[model samples]
Target: MPDARTTAFDIDLYHIDAAYLAWKSGYNAPSAFELFTRGTPFRGGYMLTAGLEPAAEFIGNFRFTREQLAWLRTIKPYEDEFFEMLGAFRFTGDVYAMAEGEIAFAHQPLLRVEASFVQGMLLEAGLLRALGIGTLIATKSARIRTTVGNCSYADFGFRRAHEPIWATRSAYIGGTDSTSYVEAAHRFNIPSSGTIPHAIVQAYPDELTAFREIARLMPKYMLLLDTYDVDQGIDNAITAAKEEAANGSGHTLMAVRIDSGDLAAWARLVKSRLVTAGMGDVKVLVSGDLDEFKAQDLLATGAPIDGFGVGGNLAVGLGSIESDYIGGVIGAVYKLSWIDLPGDDDDRMKIAGSKSTWPGKKAVYRFGDFDHDLVTLDHELAPDGGRPLLHPWMKEGTLLHSHPSLTEIRERAMSNLAAMPTWLKALAPEQDYDVRFSDELVALRDRIVAEHK
Candidate 1:
């Protein structure tokens, strides 16, 4: 695990320079930065907020280490005063954010930081990374959850995950029933599940022996098929299951996993064979570079697949070529939105072409089953029947409250997913949910732009 006490050196050198320059030039006004993405990931209608726990931790514990400061002295001819400031620095800011697992739209502020200009600048990279990757994985898992419907889904992507720990947590938040990452499971109290690998079957003289041994050891076990011959593997599994039942050793044959071949066809065949052998209750779980699209296709074929164990597609964010839509990446950017100087408060924005951003501290108000969202200046009154999505997370550098449990976040994700409009849930949604800016927010942006002109 990385240190919970994030050091100032964790940020990019440019951000450090920017902060240094700001401080040197006496530009030490309070500033607000909003973390938002310009568009949804995976061509989806919405994203699930995640990584708030880590982001908050980073902000709460942000400090400069002695070693880091010593190293900084070697790199640049910065003054002793700056080092003194760095050594004494602590984040004394406020953070407002949507709860983890809350559904968010493009341009909505998932997290907003109210701090000094230097503090806000220093937080840009870390906040973006933590929230961006976490949100991407969570959104992908949510799509998979939608595809699988009531069927079981588990994360088998640890080996392929960019960061196994975060991926596992995000996957669970996205509605997976379990994860194969044991460490993550232990840390987060997520249910961990897995069966023998193909290598284990290869280690044995025959499939039946391996199956028998696994059944003897485990109270319940899923046999791995397709290591050699699918038919022989299935036959051996059935034999082992029957023998285990007759032996009265209290072992249960829970399911059989198919990792290769035409998964849908194989699942149907496996289901029929299990039913014929009086083991119909046993599940048929399939895994092989699977994603929501493939899972949906397989289920549509009525493959009798009871569960999915997704690996690479779930762990890694390699976008699909067929869909021509990038996966596994959320382009969340942290931009300065408001600056509070002595007796002067200024709204800020970026107007470089399509990258223009909304000015001022903002609030997102959701209404009517996520049918519409209104973005307005933070101080604006909520539209009637509007539910404010952003809430106070931290005040004066201290967390206002503890985060909800992972299970609670997962439930929230599922509930939000269920509330999504039917058309938005489609694998290729053609319409976007209504997201609009309040007239005041638009007017503020216009005024800022006109002033710049």
Candidate 2:
């Protein structure tokens, strides 16, 4: 699904955890959670990390609407003081995170948050939701890009996107050259691309007339070829192009789009006809149930496809989730890693075995040209020839720096993908690229587990 929550008002739904919110806020015993969140697509060994900027933006502007607060008051176990404090709550925490578009491996903390128990805990749902959907789209887009190479890929998932806002953004970040989501185009400064629907031809006297009118209205147009017979649609497109050329509007059909039939065969036939008619400059665009696998199959036929409009599958992630707006959610968690004890600073972690987590503030460092990563205690310095991946994205409620433009972020994503090892990039991974955990940290975790057991 494309971006779901367009306005801040829609965020009132985060009020879902009112009781826990009230309880954690007042439980004053020096509580803290080292939010070591990680999320990815299914069978994924590596993910192109993203959503940090949006998550930070949500945190920096954290708020409960008046209606949301009023509703929270209706829930049981929430005292007046809780509501009073909730109305004034601000995320005055410190955040360290991998830059959006960095390559992130499994079990590594893509983001870490430090603040009081409540300020941090309250943020978990929103942050994880944003991170999960964005990460999913980015991962999927990269997979398609790996297969598509230099051809242009645009996001046509806007209508089917569970939500439009993040979905479009995710698709773009994931590597779509353009998007059909108009508002997202305006907001992100991305070039808007879309084709006329079948309804346009239906509204007109005939397909040829619709194409001619549309071409007159806009010099460049991708005439939808499947609304009627695919063959006739191409013929109409050529006629419209010729008529427009005679009108001196100087427009030829930008491309001929096929939304149905065998994409590969149709694309080959369409390309062949366009060439026979001396319109070789025109391109063939195809769209119909496209995932990376389908896109791969289409390309495998050696069809002359110049562009694609990917829907449904691109909107859904590798795994499915029980949600109306989205088909999936990444499994991510926030847990207490530290709680101040008088005169004591022992490392702390959950001891659930296999569900256990590392303790203390953590840092992720990359070795070489994104060959691998090491997760170490924050105080430890980067290894020789190693570069720290996490940087101070935010500090004490203020942004540490302006966010990189989406173009820059997309370039970074492409760089990360280009460096990926072939095995991990396989649709079914050959092996996992584990993030090396520090020896001392592992020992401390073992010690904690033994004592708890």
Candidate 3:
């Protein structure tokens, strides 16, 4: 094998140091502190600091192998100078961030990385891409988790998701209690659970045969109905469930999942049939491109659906969020603010319309009473009084503290979700959430925007 020295770092660590070095040089920072300081390059009340741990790992262990460097030589405009620079890149930066699973509103910085412009700038792409996508999914997951109440929601979007890892990470982060993809579950420590697929049901001569075989294999399993005849499918599932229950195999009739037809009516009919047959304990799980609007509407009907299996719409971020919820496509640019060295002030700005960024490090305060958990539109709490939501996650390519485990993050997510008003968690928009900017950040943005004009 080629010597480790000649290789690019591990896949996870591939971009951290290089990204940091690139960022620093790209922005021409005199020192790392200058790139992330108050009145320095990054100007915002605060950054929504995320993906630092992975980014840090990337930087600390970054080394381009002879193989990677050789590939570099294959490209044109490959300056010996740039190649030489790439040879020695390593990331060393400080990052302040919100704890994973913290409730963040639009326009708020979720995580911020502070390092020399060279180091920080280099790390930008991988860091943002890693953190932004996950957080976006996690935020959406929190909302969906909120609406589901006590019912179990599983991730069924793997086959339909944009990618495999998304099926794993995004689905789990979003509030799916389980997944049908075993690999996704194994990779992310998510639970894997499911009922029979239509293909399996299609193979059998009749629905009863399919149900008998399935129940025989996994006695405690949930069974899928709605193949040829919806009513017949339910009757078969009931018969199979009853046989499994009677065997005293400790397998009670778990659930009958419905995937087609009018879900509300079908669910009611199925429940009525099950109840009539003394299968009151059997649940009715609904799936099939369910979104918040559909789920909420179904819930409004007081149907017999014990659980909902939302697929494409929830997993892919469909109509749940309005374009305006993106809120003016607010430019949250990461910019090169001030670079204060001995005799040079490289305090400059990027081009306009590229999303202007504020200068200096910053923070935000959310003011409200604990009662009913109200977050006022413009009223900010005294900075000292309100609990600070953002904190230090990393410094100089080392983690500042143990990032909370995924379970902890999930728990925190649930709490924040519980505090939100039902209307805010509604599938459709009533109003944009109100969040105030600190006077400091507001003033800084104004100054920068005016300068750009």
Summed backbone clashes in each candidate are 1, 12, 35
> Highest lDDT, which number?
1
**TM-score, cand. 1 vs. native:** 0.97
At residue 139, give the lDDT of candidate 1. 88
Tens digits of per-residue lDDT for model 3, 276-380 = 998888889999867655677788898888888866654454443422233111122344444545564344444455344444454544555221112211234
lDDT by residue (206-293, candidate 2, tens digit) is 9988988999998677889989789888888888888888889776687878999999998888888899888998988989877777
Backbone clashes, candidate 3: 35
- Model 2's alpha-carbon lDDT is 0.74
| TM-scores of all candidate predictions against the true structure | 0.97, 0.89, 0.80
- Candidate 1: the clashing residue pairs are 319-327
Better of 2 and 3 by lDDT: 2
How high a TM-score does candidate 2 get? 0.89
lDDT of 1 by residue, 1-453 (tens): 346665566689998788889999988788999999999988878788888876766676678888888998999788999888888888888999999999998999999999999888988988998899889889888889999988989999999998788888988999899988899999999999997799998898988899889888889898999999888889999999899889999899998999999999888888899999999999999998888888888999988999999988877755666667688678889999999776665888999878999999999999989779999999988789999999998898888997789999999998998988878877678988799999999988888788888
lDDT of each: 0.88, 0.74, 0.59
Among these predicted structures, which one has the highest TM-score? 1
